[model samples]
Target: MQEKNFITVDGKRFHYMWLRDNCLCPECRDPNSFQKIYDISEAQSPPKPVSVVEEDDKLTITWQEQPIHQSVFPISWLMAHVNELDTPVQSSRKIILWNKTDLQKERTVRHDFHNCDFDVWVNQLFSLGFTILENIKSTQELESFICSMGPIYETYYGRFIAFIIAMRYTLFFPSSLFPLPSSLFPAPKSLLRSPCSEVPKNQRFVPHGYKTCYIPVKPIKGTEAVDLAYSAVGHPLSPHTDFTYLNLGRLLQFIYCEENNASGGESIVVDGYRVARDFRQNHP
Candidate 1:
């Protein structure tokens, strides 16, 4: 057995363990069942490849051991796992930064849900950090649309939470002044008088275990005397990405606007990656 756990096959290097695990022979893998018959731990030492040959995309390897004397691999399968084998494949699509002129030229970025293809939608999202999707009639339709792409990534905030000031009036009272009921302390529905008895089941936006908090952007009539933080006074929120510490980072943040009567709540987006690139180029 060779100490080096790699072998060059058809000009591509593959791990010995990876090659051994993917053995397609009838002894290693059941012909009818297709399940692996050989246990990975059964190999006492690294199985070394003594001979390797390629014919018409098929790769054959002769090992220097018994019970798993030979193995065959397809070139296509080997190429597909090139990244896993520590080979980097360059991507064709480059990230493009947009200016005001670029935004004007690409004004028709909004895709209609009824008419858009999945690949087109995904491509647009990949190219641009965010995209506008119009004509999504209801919440159910939006949920269904997202579910089609993949599972909804529930975070510390849970699946979804809509911030409506009126619904969370009870939360404004200090816990010292008005101690919260044990049932109403943690859950979003605790703020409600009757836990969504009035709203229809389907229309209920906040799912169970979802956390909710409401901050008034505009000052209420009586609360004008109390000085508040800049955020409470409708100041521009500092641009930031959410949940970067978590695995994969927050996948996406969806904002649904029901109404926009108040001022100074406009959305701002900046490509952090593009900014870093520009900074490095200029500074260096």
Candidate 2:
């Protein structure tokens, strides 16, 4: 039986496999990462759309197979990619950057907490990288509001990360023996430890409107050197985790070096839940 592609937006009909492959739904694509979980070639059979409907400038397609799935594509997305869809692969679109004036213009936006369109907030976050949200009642409210967008990706932090500031201000401190910033200064009860920084920056964020001065600690011999080259090339390097911003999370995978010239620490996979269970049984 021949299936016709009735999904049309902006006078452009998207290919079946392309639409299926680029499915923005949480199942086919990771809600957090935005990576495609659905692969076109390895599919058991070609993507066959049995039903297509267009509403509110979105095309929804239901596949003609078991383990039912649907793909939704926005009209704007289809219109922008009309030409690119025909190509083998397409380059990523450049990010939209803004200046201080652009941010000041947004200040006029009245944040009505009760009647909120989180979709607009999500769009603002995607385009501007960061959008200010205030007057959220509690962590529960925040979680519920956030989950309205997609599935929750549980963070490894001891508590919830309700707020995250995007801008990175790298501060170089002279102290070599400092503990990891998050562990050192814990976030107050519920809120996240603001500005999770990379290991390179040995300092926390100092907000503007405060005049501050720093006196560098005297360098001691046999201490870790603050050099990017040293971190990359130095053998038997200091103990540290990769992607420190992630803070020892469950997800990220360890990769083998492409050119294995020198040996690095073994990549250990530990089941966090299992470890916690054993610890509780033994200790309690």
Candidate 3:
């Protein structure tokens, strides 16, 4: 049977342990296996008061570390180390806060953005996380954008609500741990070729002559989707990420069809990376 104990520090029972040995710091854990030690030390204690809350079977801990450190821990992990603790241990959680002023400025930019100012919008995307290019001349322009760089590839995961090829351009972006967040939109269906009998009747679409196309990362098991082209009529596309494979430094590329008979659907891009970085710079 599993046993549990409370850790007392500074005359307060924290119901947990604190030791360099018991610390779950990433450096102390095995990268391959992701397991750590449970040793608690006597010299360890937080300089400031830390708060703990117990709800049902889960434990929520709050510390001086603001946004990042505040998290819920499983009661089981707490019980495993509480028995041998003597003092408060340093938590690796770093608190982060969103900058309200910058956020407001960004909102103003979004509200003030005009379709005529494509260059300004592009620069904004470079400063932000992603960019949108409206008034695309034709499907050829969309194709050209996706095919601008070498060694690019499109993917088909069959998960799209409306069947369209999703191009996955992995080459563009820096390999930074801290980078700008970004996202993109699919092209129009007029650019792809038909997906013959190899695709299901309901799932089949005309492929848009995209070479080196592959499958997108699985949003669901046993399913596949790719970037072809999106329809222009009332395609209310919200902001979205492509895959978890992406790192921090990434640029979002979006092209919207601006032809006649187009109902409604303005392109919208965001700069989540800039938002985070600005927040960190201003707050930190």
Q: Identify the leading candidate in terms of lDDT.
A: 1
lDDT of model 3 at position 8: 38
Q: Candidate 3 on 1-284: residue-level lDDT in tens?
A: 11133433333344333322334544434333334422222224432225656677665545443333443556666665444534753544422232445545563334222243655554554454443344566545544544443223333322111233212211110000111221233334343334432322122233233332433432211112122113221113344344455433343333233232223334444555555476458644
Error of 3 at 249 (Å): 6.2
2 or 3: which has the higher lDDT? Answer: 2
Model 3 spans with C-alpha error above 4 angstroms: 1-125, 153-241, 247-252, 255-268, 277-284
**Each candidate's root-mean-square deviation in Å?**
20.3, 22.3, 15.0
Each candidate structure's TM-score, on Cα atoms with residue i matched to residue i, is 0.46, 0.32, 0.33
1-284: candidate 2 lDDT, tens digit per residue: 12363355666666676688678896765454444446555678868887788889887888886888888888787887785523343335333445545556664333555775767765665455445455655445544565554444433422232111111221221110011112111112222232333322333322111122222322211123333212222223222243345543333211211122222323332333344466458644
Candidate 2, superposed: residue stretches over 4 Å from native: 1-6, 84-284
Candidates 1 and 2: which is better by lDDT? Answer: 1
Task: Give a tens-digit lDDT track for model 1, residues 147-213.
Answer: 6656766544445444332221221111000010001111223334454434321122233333433
Q: Rate the local accuracy (lDDT) of all candidates.
A: 0.52, 0.43, 0.36
Q: For model 3, what is the error of residue 118's alpha carbon versus the real structure, in angstroms, after optimal superposition?
A: 11
Worst-scoring 10-residue span by lDDT in model 1:
175-184
- Compare candidates 1 and 2 on TM-score and give the better one: 1
Best by TM-score: 1
Q: Clashes in model 1: which pairs?
A: none
